[model samples]
Target: MSPVEPFSDDSPLGASGAEGVRALRVAVTRPLSGERLENLLRDAGHAPVHFPLTRIEAPSDPRPLARGARALLRGEMDVLLLTSVRAVRSLAQALETVAEGPWRRPEGLQVWVIGDATGAAAARMGLVPDRIPEHFVAEQLLEEASSWARLDGLRILFPRAAAGRSLLPETLARAGATVTLVEAYRSVDDGEEADRLVRAMGRGELDLVTLTAGSQARVLARAMRGTRPALRCAVPMVAIGPATRMAMVAAGLPEPTVAAPHTVEGVVAAVKTVAGGLQ
Candidate 1:
């Protein structure tokens, strides 16, 4: 058998069948994830261990975020595109920083989010989530947005992380929308968190590791640097999407199981895919 096995396009739960499988200890690497992903894994009979390897911080310059918020306040922007829950909260903080409380959005502005978590964050902020794509990737969000509204001459405000992919904004620009891409927050590596993860792998405790973003994969690979190559590749890894999978490979790690739909639910299902494969 190959040292690092890969999964096929089989149904996620196909191997479980009528019999039960052993629960896996899945290391979830998202920062401040809390119980959302954990509870989902437990409900599926898997033990999720918190191994946060990345943390979010405010960008060095708040001017761009402030400008984006001010544009929305002044009704200068026609659309708001949020890619992550962190982006939604960061942008909202920028709004409260610029104006008084209870500042409502311009009625003409349409709000669209990428993930269920992003939409939920918007709803928690008392903002209506006008649209959310069925899939949680930027491409899906762009497709869904284009399907509903005319992108021509639209002034769209995209509040996201400092190192986010440019595909969404670039594609929107090509589609004739003027996109204001703001770096609302930045994801930084947590040295202590990385140390803990490396320790766990050394102890051989983790059955699988989950990667949500490219940063997480890169951090993990960097953290595990100098360790035995086989030790790092011993456990299977699952990524939330193609970008993350590519990150895993580029980080000198084996290719990861890419989640379909790229949602948190899809991540849960990916873990199940690994579980079913083990059985």
Candidate 2:
């Protein structure tokens, strides 16, 4: 399956050209990746704020992660699936923290990533993915898996966020694939950051809210209640993809303006597009 199609120049949310993003205060909700987005926004002449809604941490229980890593090393697993770049780092951390001596990935084991960013993360650790969906998303990853690989009885090791979507593993299991899902990382909401966001929203200091992950959208929604005027805030949510947009709606937040290419640059273009049209 191809990646979700990117947005066109004439995106539904009015077009904000390059000049439209000038001096706009954009609140970013991504954690470790927020810096990258901030840089992009700055390049576009928009003011970017770093307000991480959640923190990605190592799992409370490390045994499952260690076991999964050991299985892959021993060639007991056929595929290693990474959903996010953070997952790749977390997996490496789990392996080093749990095992002794130098850790080496087995040669025969195939690795699959959900997107280009995750694939780049894997490559940084010397683990190149055999396949990455043309479109970056769990559903697309599953589609590619079913189309290319024989899943019946195939053992796949999936290391992902603790609260990651269940569609990939659940669907793979139904297809008779022996999938082992382990939590390599955990996403915990940062109350202090949420408070700052509440304050910003209350004073109308925030011009735009960007949600890179679905979890951040949920956290932002809860934070909204602390604001003096919740519904009237004209701040538009900028979501990186449809999944995040869905989460925003499910949480009763305003419908987000979506980024089509689903990259940081896509997000900048989305900002320009929205800001351009809203002007």
Q: What TM-score fits each model?
A: 0.86, 0.88
Q: Write the per-residue lDDT of candidate 1 for residues 143-217, one digit (tens) a residue.
A: 777787899999999998899888999999999999999998999988678778777777777788898999998
Model 1 regions lying over 4 Å from their true place: 1-19
The true-structure Cα RMSD of candidate 1 reads 6.4
Instruction: List pairs with backbone clashes in candidate 1.
Output: none
What overall lDDT goes with each candidate model?
0.81, 0.79
Best by lDDT: 1
Model 2: CA > 4 A from native = 1-21, 226-233
lDDT of 2 by residue, 32-55 (tens): 644678888867766677788898
**Candidate No. with top TM-score:** 2
